[model samples]
Target: MTTAEAETGDTLTEALTEVLSGARARGGLFHRAVLAPPWAVRVQDGAPLSLACMLRGDGWVLHPAAPQPVRIAPGDVVVLCGPTPYVLADDPATEPGLLIQPGDCCTTPDGTDMCEKLALGVRTWGRDADDPTVLLSGNYQLYGDLSTRLLDTLPPVLVLREGEWDAAVLPLVATEVVKDAPGQQLVLDRLLDLLLVSVLRAWFARPQAQPPAWYRAQSDPVVGVALRLLHEHPGHGWTVASLAAEAGVSRAGLARRFTGLVGEPPMTYLARRRIDLAARLLREPDATLASVARRVGYADGFALSTAFKRLRGMSPAAYRAEHGAR
Candidate 1:
């Protein structure tokens, strides 16, 4: 086998890590559940991603299209990408007793509120306190448009079995979720991000995994260095010739190889990266539109606003307002 084929696995892993980092968790929902037998909760399709871990006892995750529900044992982590509803229950035969809607709202099937009724303690909720089953669940609410590349690559359901990955941060997240102190939410958000990266790292390492084209293209010697440079310095004014020179290849060779491997020309990819970075910066209160524009390679706020509105369907100020940023 050639050098490119040999290093494909390592390059794909690095590319996935880079892509996933673009969708950093802002403020998500975390809940600690303690339940007993004969109980089930129907999770609606709203959040972009949902993560559940079996902390104690066992349960089953039922999907509508699956022939059989998946069993979840202790230490098992499951990630569900929506909008597809699923059920978590003690057994596959159990009917859903409660419904979970967007914004973490809970209710009965008949539309009666259940959030306050099932509250156990800080960040804790379930049918019973001394229940046999315990679970740690998190929901990622806000993901930028750039995350579509990574999210589209994932399956509807992914399960990482116990001992398959290192989850040292799980315990820390479980502990911090119940804290009512200041900055506790921030702590949980960071921990959830770590958990997600760790799980994906393990999943992509499986031999049978079929990574995306861009991920696979990172193995090429020329494409790999160019990708790194583009990702590391999105604000730099990069042209085809400049990128080719930096990667030690002629302009024509680099353009052909990069387009063939990555499915897009180098300049197009760079533009997308700059827009992604600008979106993230717009969420900061101190970062003005002009400042964000300059930092992301645009000439001024007007140039950035035009592109942002064209690509994101909103101006920078409108985007910030929608996201509740100052």
Candidate 2:
């Protein structure tokens, strides 16, 4: 993927806006709030949020719910889930292994009032953090939320140190990220969005050795078409014949290509997508198993339960009980 690939969804500006909107809509609120010196940043009241691409220069460190203080330098992007209070700090070597929470305030050992807040990128809550979180020397992307499947294959953090890719556009954006102005908050949000996109492009550019079967298939015209359709309509009653037609291939061809590229047949993808959607719906407080089953093409709650258990290794109710928000 090139910078052009990041700009692929629509016109350049529209694609950029769409990326921000996608991140915010999924995450819920886009916090354009600014915190300078004397005020520690607090996200105690929002959904699970992620901060990407925006670097925290000196004077700040991230104190997450986890005890370890994550130090931030120029080009470091971090993601925090839950309403846990993460503070920007002047000192990061204090807490080593305690679970912290929102509203939990601490002091430096000397008690000198240790942190001065700094401008960071667009912070949003409730979005998927599977995108990307990175740090780069030049054209760098600090943080992102691609998809869980993608991130699972990466090192905990991907760092693009110094090169043409780094020098291209990330540094200019980083310089602007450190600037302060009246509407700088707005500027910061947009720049953060671009920085994340750049990171994904970089990831795709330097191809992973032996990319996942799903990603490799995502490039195939037939498989890609099928994937987009499945993602767009997970609730649909997708049949192999239907998917084959949708992808403009024979049923046999589709099955073989799909298995070869996606590492599974069409039905497997459909089932996974359905179950994934069902799992998400189950997590919704208002939805019932029967309704969720119907939505994902199962004939009844029991049937959905059987299949869900097979795929997730737990009954739907148990899964929900342990994991659901409400």
Candidate 3:
């Protein structure tokens, strides 16, 4: 390795070792706060999502899961996730009920709800939304929509106690999110991206293991090129020979390098990726299984079924019924 490569690898290794050590903790590697009014929002199931953090105004609430009512006031941030219904309000009893759109409120069981006003804030996995308005005066709920594989590597929620560091960064992001300025979405997205890196840094600083093999390859020129090609062209008939040629390495060398870094040879990775593509296609109500299989490079529906079952623990039809978009 060159001096720069060696230094980069060592630095990455050390950083990963530090961050992953706290992998089992309650803290998340990504977080954000919202100051917008209560608005309506609904997320479809199987959306592959997460909430890293939420801030109201000044104080902060960490891990907003509770058996009873919890007070969320101005400047208090609460973090939560894992596909459960959570309502942030001034009165816990007044938490909005079913059919209550986002940016609104409902009632609780015993009618002892504590929050009256609502402000939505969130940290998400992707940068689809640039500036999300969180001004508390009007009724609005900040919603973020994005899908990223990186979520698989992070903890569910982490609510930090508001402090100097948070003040310096979070408010700025929240302002950008609410401003809805020109190219503000792009600006906010980039900021969130950097914030995610900061969270990862904090995680590693606390001693974490190396991230998943795919994420790690983001820094590897050789492996990154191969992975990008595979991700971007899953429909293409890719082979070890073709990929090696594209990577400018011998088949044996490419295979060795790929396996060393990705923990699997190129072909095995491709098969899994193909199956993943098939699974996604099958989830579409209009996509036929036969077409999905053919598109992913399987010869026929039966062959696709057999391979899908082996890799995904379910037949394609069953998987579609369970996960398909309704």
| Candidate achieving the largest lDDT | 1
Taking the tens digit of each residue's C-alpha lDDT, what string does model 3 give over 48-128? 233333343322222245545444343433334444444443334442322222223322344432233322233321122
| Residue pairs with backbone atoms closer than 3 Å in model 1 (clashes) | none
- TM-score winner between 1 and 3, please give it: 1
Winner on lDDT between 2 and 3 is: 2
TM-score of candidate 1 relative to the true fold? 0.84
Which candidate do you rate higher for TM-score, 2 or 3?
2
Model 3: residue 29 alpha-carbon error in angstroms: 22
Which lDDT tens digits does candidate 2 get at residues 226-311? 87677667677888899999899899999998998877788876786677667667767899999999999898999999989887
Q: What is the C-alpha lDDT of each candidate?
A: 0.83, 0.51, 0.50
| lDDT of the structure predicted as candidate 2 | 0.51
Among all windows of ten consecutive residues in candidate 3, which has the lowest summed lDDT? 135-144
How many clashing pairs per prediction, in order? 0, 17, 51
User: What tens digits encode model 1's per-residue C-alpha lDDT throughout 1-326?
Assistant: 77756666655666777777865776778999998888899999488888999999999998775677999998899988877899999999999998998878898999898889999999899878898899999988876622666686687888889888776667888888889999887787777888888888888878887776677777678988898788778788889999999999999999999999888899877877777778888878788989998899999999999988877788888888877553
lDDT at 190 for candidate 3?
A: 58
Provide the lDDT at 85 for model 2. 47
